[model samples]
Target chain A: MRILVTVKHVPDLQSQRSFTGGRVTRTADDGTMNELDEHAVEAALQLVEAAGEGEVYALTVGGADAVVAVRKALQLGVQHAIHVSDDAIADSDVFGTAKVMAAAVRKVQDEAPLDLVITGMAALDGLTSMLPTALAAELDWSQATLASAVSVAGGEVTVERHLADAHETVVAPLPAVVSVTDEANKPRYPNFKLIMAARKAPVALWSLADLGVDPASVGREGARTVVVDASPAPPRENRVTVTDTGDGGTQLADFLIEKGLA
Target chain B: MTTVAVLIDHRDGEVTRPALEALTLARSLGTPVAVWLGSVPSADAVALVGDYGATEVRVVDAEMRLAGHAAAALGAALEDADVVVVISTFVTKEIVTRLAMATGAGVVVDAAGAEIVDGRVETVQTVFAATWNVRTRIHTERAIVGIRPNTTQAVPADTPGDAVIVPVTVDRPATRERVVAVEPVERGAGVPLAEAPVVVSGGRGTGGDYALVTELAELLGGAVGASRDATDEGWISHEHMVGQTGTTVTPALYVAAGISGAVHHRGGMQASGTIVCINLDPDAPIFEISDFGVVGSLFDVIPQAIARIREHRAG
Candidate 1:
């Protein structure tokens, strides 16, 4: 079995993000692979490890810095890495980004077919949670997004999807795609030994042309939506009251009575 | 006309309020068509389609009934549609993404609004967890989108029309996974979270005591919310949990008692129109975003607030 994992490099969402003149300003802050993408990568690595005979490939699209994200996946024991890089790929929204990724996956599969394609349910930056579905649409494959758990055996892929109100168990045939949620599994941090090994691992960098994609076919231009504005959320006002500590239950009852709610 | 497919989720025969919100949004996009899966809904449900501005309604036979994967039904219903609009629920997101994948459509999840732009559907999104706003215009042959709840106020109409019910065939792919069981937790008698104008939440300071929170919620004619810590401690059911891992609520008024205002908790409730925090420590994190801050114990503050509410109501 062959597995493909899609990873993304996003600004560390933990840090405060500011914009200047309708564009996001870069911070001198440290960043890492998206946390959700890490979960997807870890899940793919786990499945490959359990199967013991399948190959895992890391795929990412971004600037030269995205190679760092691809290497992180290699450190987790993926067999190889594919970095889709180009200046033309910048500012791609979830829709356009997924289109580029789908093209890359098709190119890779043209050489070696895959049993499964995996991605994080969403990235924290935009938190659109649309990539997996958009890619699934482009690939014309069965999809299970927000996968809480996934298992592969024989030629079938089974997934437990976490829903708004309940859990759904679904099974799609081989060559299916899944978008993993945070609840799937915690991502592993690379140890010094694995990091050293990853340095020697093969990470093929491909431009959009190498993947046979037209330069005009993707990125922000391909996106359906453009952000026109961003501003700090409105600050809330406070109107709270303090209660006496003694006899809280009775006070609570009295408070309800005073409020005319009891 | 741009065919806008509206995915409706119903209980028995009643449409969920959020679905109605989606219908209201779908109307803004193009010709709104309502799609019902599983059992055919009641006449009231059909009536609601017309009332909410749905020009057509299609019913598809679902092999795995009881609110199964909405994407599957939506995918089947998109036989002749230009765009699809599904309500953003935890379940619908999973289905819409999958269906969008199989159909080669541009998929945008959790859009706040939509409009026709340059002969295409443009959607406004709340990105970066509501930190940034974006507008997307889809020029694809087909598009799939999900919309947030309460983004649009549902305007009920009196136009009576019939749903063009269509029977869709089911193609159950042979697979090993099976639906073991379906269990429902009784949502007990209270104002629905989406409909409630106010919400009162408790956190670690409550020490697992929710009596005051409930009282304040009732006083405000709202719902009770719990911090992740309180929910994890079993002080309240997980359904009441309000934080990063919990439900995001945007009510007209939100009151926090004993909560220390963890960012995770604030992420879910920060969108509320107004926020009030009551804590012994004035420096608690909750106070930073609160419109009204009272430095005191939850025990003392909640009761007094309740009393004031009663006094105002009586007058």
Candidate 2:
């Protein structure tokens, strides 16, 4: 089996995140692989290990900082890494990004026929949860998303999706795209040897030209959506702090009663 | 006037609250048209949609499992609408994204507010794990927007709606994914977390004992939630985790017990109407966003609070 896992570098959730000129002002200094994408890498690694005769490749699309995402995947036991970066790809919306990613996936498929592609349920930064479906549409491939568990056999892929009301078992043919939720598996930590090797490993860098994508068809120019305005969230006010004073529970109950909440 | 299409989400012929919220928002943009998929809207569901300001109801007869056919059904029903609104659920997000890609329309997800400004559809998005609120506009003439629940209350327009059954044929491809089975996850609970009006959440301070939290939730007819730390410690399942990475919830009242109020946890419950925090540390960050807070041990305070509430209810 030949599998490719996609990862993304996002601004750390704990950092102070903001936007400028309607674009996210990414704090690359604090950027890291999307926490959810780790599950995708772990799933791919596990699949390869289970097959005992397959290779796992990591792919990322973003600016230079995005290579950090690929490197992180490599450290998690992926054999090969590819980073697709170009100035023209900046500020691409989900649709533009999906187009570029689909093209890059096709380029990789040319080198090695892939049997499966895996991605996180959603990218932390965008949180759209739309990329898997959009990329599948662009690639004309079947997709099973938000899977809590995944298994591949007999030229088919089956997944158990944990939804709000029900746990669904979904299935698709081989060469399908699957997105795993964080509950799928626990990501393994990179050992010292793997960490050192990942630091030294070379990652192939591809641009829009390399992927046969038009510069005008990507980036801000190719974006289907535009941000008209952006501003800081208004500060929350009217917070009331109360001391325990040995009657905290009574006070809380009275407050709830007053508000008709209890 | 331009028409705004709102996808009506329903289960077993009951209109959902989020769908009503979406319809309310849709009315602000233009004439609200409620689009129902999978099943025909019952008379009461139609009347409810009308009460929520839907001027017309379009029903597309299809199975819920045929999700791939949804985009086409919606496209055919909403071909004339300038903007489309959908509730931000997992299935709707996929259908709306596919429709947007197919039509080359701009798509916005998790919008808290949407309106027509200067002849363009402008939307407010809570991004960066709800740390920043950015207002965006779609350049394209047609746009798709997914609105989160509880962004606004569903208001009645008091206008009866006209119903139409639109025939749609989905050119589904041969190699699409299929749902083989759906098993409902059972929880020891009063209500589903997403649909619960009140939620009581526990944290690391619970010390792997959710007994108190669960009891309070059940007493109040609410749902139980857990912080990531508690779930990570195996005190509860990840399904109960409320954080940026977990489920984003918006309840009428949210009670955080023994939680430190990490940004991640706040992202999930910040949209709730009334936030109450109980913790031993006065300096804990959870107190900042809380509308009401008490500096005390949850173990000591919760039992008393529960007893008081029970007594008050009985009287």
Candidate 3:
């Protein structure tokens, strides 16, 4: 019943997000754990608690500040945390990121068998929604993604996928990868005791060399995609403001009629 | 001419509009070859592909799963093609990623338009929650691109409809995820949010009462949408949320009632043709983008507007 949840450290969406030199300019000052990943951690913790004898570990890959994501997970009741950071891992595309994460998961498995790997539906920054499948391909495990609800029993994992058009139930065997949506659970706020403990917890740090990964196969050099050009969106203009002088609705209806939109 | 492979998504032998849009976009770059993943292509499906300017349709008789296997199937078949075009969906995103991994090609998702520039495939993406448009080129010999639906209108081209049955070896690893059941959600009756020509959205200003919003949407024959705040408060489902993280919509007319219009929510509906806003706050950000603004309470404004529209229609 041991589970590993993948978390990410991303720039807060409320901040002014921009790109520089054909790359996303992420400032560590405003970065925090991806909001969606909270559901993954919550789901894993619930599963472990329900089973009564298991552990939940949180894993993240980013720069030094990324350890904050793992620390956040520990505060949510996860037992162990691992952070894989290397200078060469910067600007790694989705494929390279998946490779590094898969390698790290394997390394973790060597110490203890992993029954499940969980992740959020998508990172707020990239919004790719491709990592869970890529990691499943790398680990050669079954994958169920975008699950709104999940339950594991009898060496099988079942999930309800809440797609735009329909709701579907999907099932995969044990040792599978699954990505949960924000509707999966409400993440509990860390208690004062756990919050203090998390600040003091030692986060295991691993390097690319430690994972036996070739530096040349990842990072900017290994990325397949390139941003040729970027530009800001044109500013919106030509707005007409109307004050409600008791006939505002009449004016609005007239405006819609004038535009042939009513 | 370079060969462009377009994945044709269909259901029960009917070609979806997004698939036709993909084919139309593919035809702009090079010779388009439609790759049908399901059962043998029916006559109507072949004709539809031809109308979208596909030179030839390649039918792959395989049960495609959302898992990475469908990408493997297409990747194996598209070895000779220069570019692969797929509709950007939850399933196709993963397929495109797998295709890139298998072929050592770069991949782009959510592209609004794509064309060959300087002998390289260039894709324009609406990034930063649709606040910016970034042009990118995959630095590879071959490229896989995921085009968002409604990015461009599907235009017909003169072509001789031809079909080819290609036997594909799907080199998919053992599937990790399997769909056991599919239940249709009960949405009652209304145009789908993505396909509707008009959308009426409410926000936190609704104060947990979507009655006015839904009524106005029904009167307008449009879809009902909600801001993230409303959805977060359990007033509506996340699917109906229109924002950066929710459904991006481009409709002819969008009515914002009680929405203060945060940047994230504005990103989803800014592409709409005409916008109308009704809010108590005159200084709401929504007023900046709206073509018509009514500074009043939605509870007071919506009912009057709806009644006037109905009366006008009856006349």
Candidate 4:
């Protein structure tokens, strides 16, 4: 079995992010490596390891920073790394990003047909969580989102989903796309040897032209939705009425009463 | 008439709240049509859609298929629908997203609110982990929107609208993946995080002791929440994690204990109606946005608060 995992690089949530005149700016404090993508990479690693005789390829689209994300995937257990790079590919919205990724995946599949494609359920930076869906549409594949557990065998894939009210178990055939949730598994730390190897590994860089992608149909221009304006929400009034005081019973009751009823 | 597709979310034949919210939003976008995929529409489900101004209710027999399989059928009917307003749960997001792409329509997710702006439907999204609110206008031929539940109240219209059952075409793709089985979670553990009115969250400062947080939540009849640090450290379950990388909650009241109020953490619960903080550090960031704050340790404050709640109950 061959597995393909999509990874992304974004300002790490731990880092402080600020926008200067509508553009997001980041600093060293902001960590990177699209956190959710880690879950995807981890899932791929576990699946390949479980198969015992399979290959896992990590793919991403970005700039030099993206190489770091791809390298991290290698360290985590991907046998190879494919990083699609182009000046035109930077800063694309969800729709455009999905298009570029689809193109990359198509090129990879040409060389190595993937039995399964895994991605993080959502990127914390965009929070749009639309890429997996868009990619499935472009590739015309079945999709399972928010998968908590996935096991593939006999050309069939079984998934456990974390639903709003309950858990749902689903079984689908192979050659499908699955977006993993954080609950799926904890991402493993890359070993030092693999990290060193990742540093030395040659990351395959493909441009839009190299991938045979039509720039006009796959970037910012092709986006169906565009942000008009973004602003801070209106300030909320401060209504801090402390209720838990030293008094055990009366004060608690009084606090509730002051808010409305006693 | 424009066919507006509404994904009816249900469990055990009972329609979920967010699905009704989507139905309400669908009415404003076009001629409302409710599409039930997994099971036959119960009388109760049909009535809910009828009350919400759905002109038609389309039910596809698909309890045995993978979740995404039924979406193909709905997408065909919605190929010409002016708009599709899907309840944006994790399940529906993937299905509706595929439908949106297949139909070549514009897709928007986590839409908190929507309206016809300048003759085009415009929607608001909580972007950058709720740090920024963005409004986008949909100018495409078809609009696919994922609306956040509870953001808009679902008030069924007084007048019952016309209902029609249309034939839905299902094209099962030759996919290798299928759902083998489903195991429902235990019941009545606590309020569903999304629907809970009050949430009591603990952070790294709890030191792996959730006993107090649980006690406080039980007293208030709320759900227990955790920061990413707690979940990452294995001190609490990931289900309790609430942050930029975790669940986004908008409860009526949110209580933070032993939390430093990291920016990522704030992104999750900032939308709450009221925020109260209990931290040992007077300078903790959680206090900045908190409506009420106590400068003390959890060891001191939580016990006192729980004791007070019991006292009130006894008195």
Candidate 5:
């Protein structure tokens, strides 16, 4: 049961996030592993540990700051880490990113085949939820996404997906892409032993050349869509905040009734 | 005029609100063509779509709930179409992304509005957890867009059509993943959160007691909602969670009680028409976005508000 878990580096949700040149601004200190991707790391570790004889690898694609993401994964007990970085990788859309990731997975598979690729339901920064499907299509592999619970046995993986309308049990063959939701499991806190080991571990860094990807086919040049304009939406008008008094609740009722919303 | 394919989402023989909203949006771009997947559309469903400006309804029988097969079928059915529109849900985003990748079409999801400006698809959407609004353009020959619900008004056509139903047969590619079993999740009483005109939500300040929150919602004829903190603490089921990853709703009136308004929670309800909040801390971020806010304990504020509303109704 060789598994690879994909992680992303995103700005902390509490921070004042802004865009630079129509792209999300990222700084080394203000970033961490995407909150949702921790669930994917947890899923991969659980699948390998349960098998009793397998390895879990963590992979991330971004700038130098993205190394933090894979390192965070290592603190959770992943054995190997890989970071794919290049100047041309910046400003790439989901398709371009997926293409770069698929190439790196193939290179890893060449040395030793991986049976699964686990990912978060979506990267919180974008919240597009398109990467898992794009990565599956790029690798021509099966995809079972938005899984609330997952288990693997008999050369197959099954996942339970909870959608708006139904709870579905879905099955796919080996070498499949699976995305787990926050409901999948509670992510474990980093262990002191693993944290010490992860600090000294060497991470393999790869570029577009190492992954056999064209530089021009990625980055902004390869983007399918273009951002024509970006600006903050105007703030709400005439906001009112008052300290509670005896009449506070009555004031609330009067406002709602005045607006005919009650 | 260019052809626009609108994916009509239907359940229990009724067309969903977002699909109708998509049709209303589609008419602004070009001719509206309704694409119905899975269960066949009933006569009433067809009539409703036709009244909303869809002249033709194409029915395809297959397990479209799965994204892969749906993508393959859509690829074949939309060879002549120039633009595709669907509701921005988790499953539909995947389905359209696959089609967009296969056909070299640019894709956008969670868009508030999309239009064909100067022969290109341009869209406006909220970013950074709904704090900023950004506009994007699709430079590809074809485009796919996932529109959010409650963002557009459904309008009737000046002249209705027959909405002629045409059966489509396409050799959809075989998918490796298969749905083995399915169970319907039971819905709670009153209106569903997404469609409710008024929503009253609680957070950690409630201390796991939903009695007052439920009372306020019931009094306003609204649905109950819970912040991620409340849901995580088992105060409410996951179905009632409202956040970026959970349910995103745009009700007419949104009331938050005891919620500190994290960025995740704000994204779900920031676009609501009228916002009101009750929290112990006046400096909570939720107060910044609230149209009306009261700084007090929810326990005291909600019960009193409910009583006052009842008095107003009686008077």
Candidate 6:
């Protein structure tokens, strides 16, 4: 089995986040591998282990700082790391990003036929949950998303997809794109040996030219939707906080009644 | 006026609140057309669509439980639409993505609302975990927009629509995926979380005992929600989780019980109209955004609140 897991470098959830130029401001200092992608990395690693003879490739797209994402993937034992970075790749929308990802996947396929592509259900920073589908569409591969449980056998990938009303077991052909939810598995922590080796690991750096994806077809110029305005939400007014003096609940009820919210 | 297609979401022959909400939003954009995928809709369902100002109901009889298949069937009905609107859900987002890919339309998901600004679809959404409001315009002719539930209030049209029924047929694309089996999940009695006007959620503070949280929700006729902490602890099903990556709720009243209101938790419910919190720790971040906050154990405060509500009803 040969699998490529897409990872992202994202602002830590605990840190303050803001948007500049109508895009998320990314600084090298405070970013880490997206928390959710760990589950994707775990899924890919587990699948490789189950097959007993396979390769797991972790790939990311960003500027120089995004190498950290693939390095973190290496700490979890991915055999290869590739970072696709370019000056022209900034401000890319989901479609633009998907185009870049499809190119990178094809480059890897050139090395050897890849059996599967895995990604987290959603990126922590964007939370758009659109890339897996768009990438599959770009690659014209079968897509299975939001998988709570996944298994591969006989060139077919099966996933237990959870929905609002029902749980569905979906089956798709190999060379497909799959996105796994956090419920798929408990991500394993990086051990001391793996963490040390990750520091010295070699990462393959690619550009839009390397993947043959047009620079004009990605980045801000290729974006189909443009953010016109962005601003912070104004704070709520007339906030009242009360300490419990044995009547806190009554006070809450009175407040609710006053607002007709009870 | 351009055609604005609203994908009607229904189950068991009844329409969901979000679908009506989508139609309500659609009416503002242009000629509202309701797209129904599956067997023929019941008369009441068709009327409900018209009541919300859908000028036409185009039913595509097919099996679309899987998004990959649904996207293919949906593409045909959307050919004439300038904008495609659907209630943003896990399944529908993928469907919208495929539709956009097929038609070369710009797409936006998790949007709060969409409007035609100067002959193009402009979408308003809360991003960066609901801390920021963003306005984005689609550059393409057809825009696939996925609006979150409960963001727009559903109002019937001034003059009810003359919903002309149109049957649509499209060759189902040879999709690469198929659903082999489906199992229904049982949910507790209450309003669905996404559409509930009042949401009462518990967290680590509940200590695995949701009796009080569930009681408070039941008292208010609200849905019971959970912080990622509680859901991760297996205290509640993932469906009940209210967080950034989980279910985002914009209820009229959101009551956080024992949740510390991390950015993840806050992103989901901060858009609510009224916020209240009960936490033993006075310093919990949830208090910052709350209109009313009580520094006390949820166990004690919830029972008291529930009792007062029951008493208020009796009086």
Best by DockQ: 6
lDDT of 3 by residue, B176-287 (tens): 5677888776674775676567899999999989999999898877999999899999998877988756777877789999999997798678877789999999889899
Per-residue lDDT tens digits of candidate 6, residues B52-147?
Answer: 998789989866676767887788887788889998887888888888877889999989998898889999998766778999999888888999
Q: For residue B36, what is the lDDT in candidate 2? A: 84
Weakest lDDT window of 10 consecutive positions for candidate 6 chain A: A12-21
Better of 3 and 5 by TM-score: 5
Model 1 misses residue A122 by how many Å? Answer: 1.7
Q: Give the 10-residue window scoring lowest on summed lDDT in candidate 6 chain B.
A: B61-70
What is the CA-based DockQ of model 1?
Answer: 0.29
lDDT of model 5 at position B73: 76
Model 6: fnat (fraction of native contacts)? 0.83
What TM-score does the A-chain of candidate 4 achieve? Answer: 0.87
Q: Give the number of the best model, judged by TM-score.
A: 6
Quote the TM-score that chain A achieves in each candidate: 0.86, 0.95, 0.94, 0.87, 0.96, 0.98
Q: Per DockQ, what order, best first? A: 6, 5, 2, 3, 4, 1
DockQ-best of 3 and 4 = 3
Poorest lDDT segment (10 consecutive residues) of candidate 2 chain B? B166-175
Residues B1-315, candidate 4, lDDT per residue (tens digit)?
A: 556788777767877777778887877766788887765676667877788888777777664344456567677556557788876656566666667666667878778878777656789877665657778877677888888766777878768775666657577755545555566656456656665667889998899999988888887878899998898899976667787656778776788988888877887788776777887777788877876677667777777767765666687
* Model 6: per-residue Cα lDDT over A1-262, one tens digit each: 9999999999888787877878787888889999889999999999989999899999999999999999999999999999999988998889999999999999999989998999999987778899999999999999889999989999999999877678899999998999999889999999999999999999999999999988999998998999988898777899999999899999999899889988
- Candidate 5 docking class: medium
- lDDT tens digits, residues A119-142, model 5? 999888889999999999999999
Q: What 10-residue stretch in candidate 4 chain A is worst by lDDT?
A: A247-256
User: After best superposition, candidate 1 residue B162: deviation in angstroms?
Assistant: 6.1
Q: How well is each residue in B1-315 modelled by candidate 5, as lDDT tens digits?
A: 889999897766789877889999999889999998877788999999999898888888866777988987777666778999998888889999899879989899989899999999999988886778888998887999999887788787788877989888888788888899999878867777776778999999999999998988888888899999998899898878888888888888999999999988997889888999999998899999999999998887887888888988999
Native contacts retained by candidate 4: 0.54
- 1 or 5, greater by TM-score: 5
Q: All candidates' TM-scores? A: 0.82, 0.93, 0.90, 0.84, 0.96, 0.98
